[model samples]
Target: MTVFVLVSGLFTGPHVWQETAARLTAAGCEVRAVPLGGLGRIDGLDGLDGLDGLDGLDGKVSDPGAVTDLESHISDVVAVIDSVGGARGEEIVLVGHDYGIHPVLGAADRRARSVARIVYLDSGMPQDGVPALAAVPDQLLREQVMLLAAEAGKGAAAELPPPSREEWRLWGSVAGVPDEALDRLTALAEPQPLGTLLQPLRLTGAVTSVPFAGVLCTGSGSSIALVQARVDFGEPAFQALADPRVTFFELSTGHWPMLSSPAELVRTLLDAAAGRGHRLTPANAAGPPAHLRPFPLDVPEAPVERIGRVDLHLPSGDRPRPAVVLVHGGPVPAEARPTPREWPILTGYARYAAGRGMVGVTLDHRLHDVTDYGRAAADVVDAVERVRADPRVDADRIALWFFSGSGPLTASWLAAPPSWLRCLAANYPIMAPLPAWGRLGSAFHPAEAIAHAGDLPVVLVRAGLEVAEIAATVEEFLDAAKEHGANIEVVDVPDGHHTFETVDPTDATREAVRRAVRTVLGHLTA
Candidate 1:
């Protein structure tokens, strides 16, 4: 059988996969590293972003946000897929490494009908909606991207990493990279649109059922934990591996396996492309909750009132409603205005609590302003107490529905849950934000939440098709929930992804949200 696997080529060129491809060939398999986008000898007659003289520009201009270039690069990937084994076979395997993951995964999402296998090599978060630049971690290069995002509202993105001496050194100076390629890389290393980076890589169609795999180099364990002075993801390397389509395997080597250990890397690629199933387990497992069923809450829409110059929605109804508060994600903050833009959760979920018949209070809490988890948690606890104090609400029936930044807030509450507050319904909550570099899941920590959840009804929703960072967080949190005996329900939704699902709304993802909310709250009678 002719098996194909697409391999990610980080900042380097497609030639980077030559060694691995060679090895695969020796094993009677045809391997070709899909030279992506503007890389290699590819000619862009029209040029990216209307730039001229790009007819011979290589794919060196790596920017996540530039949708035009991403689309162009996508065209290239689509071409490669179409070209795969014209006469041989249609077994195509796709691998993405570093920035290459952007093109690799993006292409796969569009070309899943033709692709046989997909691989992410030392990749970053691959999501839908947000651009590649926004999704990429800051450590990939030296830049302040969040600041950029703030300037342009939600859709603004970072530009391509400018070709620099340091970057050149990182690639060319590396042991396996050749010195002669420096000039070529510099010549072709044009600045790409930063928009592509922030956009989430969406592949919901046949991709969900495709054989996706991640070739994680073992060295990442040492570096992810110790090198960055961050033991966050590295501590649970095995667990961090994501990609619903991926069948991850630890190829013991540096981040660039093709360069460091091509033969073994090729073997691993073959194993993955062959559709051979491997017994995979996450490294870190977040504990379980004490309760095993959803607690019924009397949820009612809490109206908005001026609280500290900000409108706050608290649970209000005729009966003493079992209350649940909405703790939302990290939003951009400004010193001049408390709530710069109305929190996303308000329209998405909080406003509808009244219709659901639960005493639900949606608070526009300070996300970026609060420095520490303790203070953040203390605020949530304060809100819980305030709602419980309300004469119209059932004090003992309070629960939490946290998302993004709320993960840490809920975790702190879980650490020392208030007697009156119920358990948590953590929806993609935050945990260890320090090391995650703003990527979802990895940044969302949940240990303290599990430890603190004292037998309250809990439901955890994580996108099963999320990248390593996001999926890892969800798995650990769910595991922790199960361990703690919390009445926990879990829904891993990858089959449902939408375009621009992050900032804006999409029908598929919106339905998924409804399912999560209804699933978690429906079980409990109001």
Candidate 2:
């Protein structure tokens, strides 16, 4: 007797959930796909004819020019909930997809007593005071979208028009979607009210008491493993995701799961409501956290000097020596204990470089999330500038080595490497963001930037057992590097994982590390 209420994302309406709702009805579940206000009225589905009882929903806004904001949409969802006995003690499983989640949360906040569970379908956990525009995957496009919305809102009825067919990729991944479905999606897509994206979602903190579920769409870029990795980094926000009340399920489809895999989405929804989805393990549940694990290599420690936020491991010599800047990877939690520069693996490599008569440098950067790549890159630039100016380091023959998630930082250097830059290296790096990151354009894609790396010696230490998404990015970079004839060398660790130095400590991994170090040093000394 559980009633399920569905809410669709931006530029979409209840019609988008028609196929999924039909399947859910066949499964003996009562389904109500709430047609949100401000998304315009659905006339009819051309290819999908004879679907009865679709038009003339109670709260749908018929006039496209009517002024509507987030409150109107929230009220629309609340109306549907109250209609279906939600206000009369009936338990309801409320589901929200993409921008639809905003209104769903707002409504759930008001009707917390009746909501059995709140489901986040392929969307970020929207926080209080943060608008939906802030959830746009690409950082650069987020700014532009907000700026355009602000400028357009001065008119009578401010609305941001839906993206064209070709422009849909900018909003979310369109993979696995059929041509007809895309056509329907574009045709029925409505102009979203600016208030929906610009106005912040206000919550009364009542919904936190309700159970939650997450339906992650892997084809669009997020997965259980990635979420776990972020949680392992001790991000306070992500820690809440590991709560036992929050369940998770992954769908191997695009952003619009209801369109690409309706039956599968329906099945997963049933499973989620039953609390049968995967439960994330708390950080340090098995043993000590990955960062605190011992280093794989036993290199002799070198004299270390801390200057501001940068650490310099100097070799035994007064003469100026070639330097190697080790840039650590992250979207690491800002409050992670010991910090990235202090991690044993980073320090191990820094000392190893110092033992080989080079000044090894490491610095903490503010790469707190995927969107902070711009800030992290600037911090790296500043650190490198300071290292080059050091009297104890050779300014003309410096090397830059990146690790893990910091891989995308190589784009700027590869596109226009300085004459004094000797070599570039990356160890198990993420060359590109996952598809779920939306079209980041070309700003952070090293796979595309490698085309411009003319004659710069590049060393890549690849992990054979790396995560599938990360491994795919490496292959993409390699292919692009080959096509452009860039000077690149590969040092493969066949049995190693992404953070192989500590996670998969073996002789093979240690040797791979040594080989990569030797290659970079050769270029620095050449």
Candidate 3:
């Protein structure tokens, strides 16, 4: 029989796994739900078959005054593993959810020979020397959490309180959870020991030999396809995920799968233990990277000169000419080869602008993640300044064109357009951060900033078949711009997808790109 050991995440105890454990037990699996030290009381655990005599239960720990850190949790899990599986001499499947994965991995590292498989359930692939706090998805909430931890550290008991019911969204998605379950989750919540979150997870590299499985909760904004997309970017870290030993399964529920879908969770866990899950396709299995694919339009190449981090595609003339600075969207993998400036689509646009008697500029920015938006915005400012100062460019007449994920960077420029700035354009851009990004503040929300665009000409090339999340943002932005009567033009490509220039190179897409370019050029040369 395979011994299954389960660990719960932040502000939660083994009691949260009661229903799932019962179902697993019925499936003839020997299950043990660990009660982490200092994570607070485990209530409603009475009559639960697998949780009897667990440590730190019934609202008390062996030593209430003792400080609990990550090591303590790891030790607790290891003790459970030894007592339950060691004596029985059975193969073990270690399962971890959310922040609980840290201790699960630490214990697995120590007892690699005993652990047959490790399953990551709706959690990130954490790296060595990184704290669990870094896994928090929201930037603003992460800062707030750090500040709270620092303040709590000065107290007699260094711990942070559980988030209230209303604040659950800050931690993760609550899509499939019932209202009563949410209330129970809040009521039984414990003050988390700060060390579990703040302390770095140390690994001895022994765990690398262990086979792994991932349980992605699609309703919580994670899926196998999304993981594959990151891997497609040629990132070394994500590339390692394509190993045959790593399998993946998807649960169509929220973050708390144990509560939202106990039966399905139990079935998936069993399949994962059997190593019968989906495998990611090897990166580059499909021709080339998306950015490297051919551009929609067929345009002549232009003379180009590299200057610092920016590339200037000069129009054929010594006299000053109107310019367009093309900005590429990313939290692109910093390790992606060839960078964005050299991508076919970006270069095609730059060369097309140059062929039309305009100076087109392409640049590499550090918008490597949602958190790096401030740095990326600064990079754009520097690139624009450099472009304006060029003797071959018209300083007073310039346009800025943004692509894909770089849409939010336009917020500041739209909110307060400079006198010399003539036009702004975006191609199937993410006008607002997705809900999974949490509240990133208004500065990155272009829909909110559209009202302040005043008389500045705004050209939008919208993809009809764009990803649902991104398309929603475009609609929201259009509504706000229209409400404020902002000077905006929409170039619609009915059959196009996001990054349509490469993915769907239909005539409509090609014409939309040309029309958008013409409108921006009209504004720049007016």
Q: What is the C-alpha RMSD of each candidate to the true structure, in Å?
A: 15.3, 2.4, 3.0
Which pairs clash inside model 3? Answer: 331-368
Better of 2 and 3 by TM-score: 2
Please list the C-alpha lDDT of all candidates, in the order they appear: 0.52, 0.85, 0.85
Q: What are the per-residue Cα lDDT tens digits for candidate 1 across 377-441?
A: 55666676677777666777766777654566555556665665555676555444423242223
Ranking by lDDT: 3, 2, 1
What TM-score fits each model? 0.44, 0.93, 0.90
Off-target runs (Cα >4 Å) in candidate 2 are 46-51, 54-59, 62-66, 86-90, 439-443
Which residues of candidate 1, in runs, are more than 4 Å off? 1-10, 41-68, 85-87, 139-159, 163-190, 198-204, 222-246, 281-526
lDDT of 3 by residue, 49-71 (tens): 55665432434453787878888
Model 2's TM-score against the true structure: 0.93
Candidate 2 worst ten-residue window by lDDT: 49-58
Question: For candidate 2, lDDT tens digit of each residue in 1-526?
Answer: 6677888998888788878877877786777778777674656744443234532244456466455778788888888777776555556888999888989999999988778998899998898888888888876667766777767767544666788998777777787889999998998898787888888999999988889899999877778877887788788878988899999999988788988998899999998888789999899997766766878888899999988779999999899999999999977889887888888888888999999999999899999877788899999999999999999999999999999889989999999999989999999998988776655446678988988999999999999998777888999999999999999999999999878889888889889888989999999999
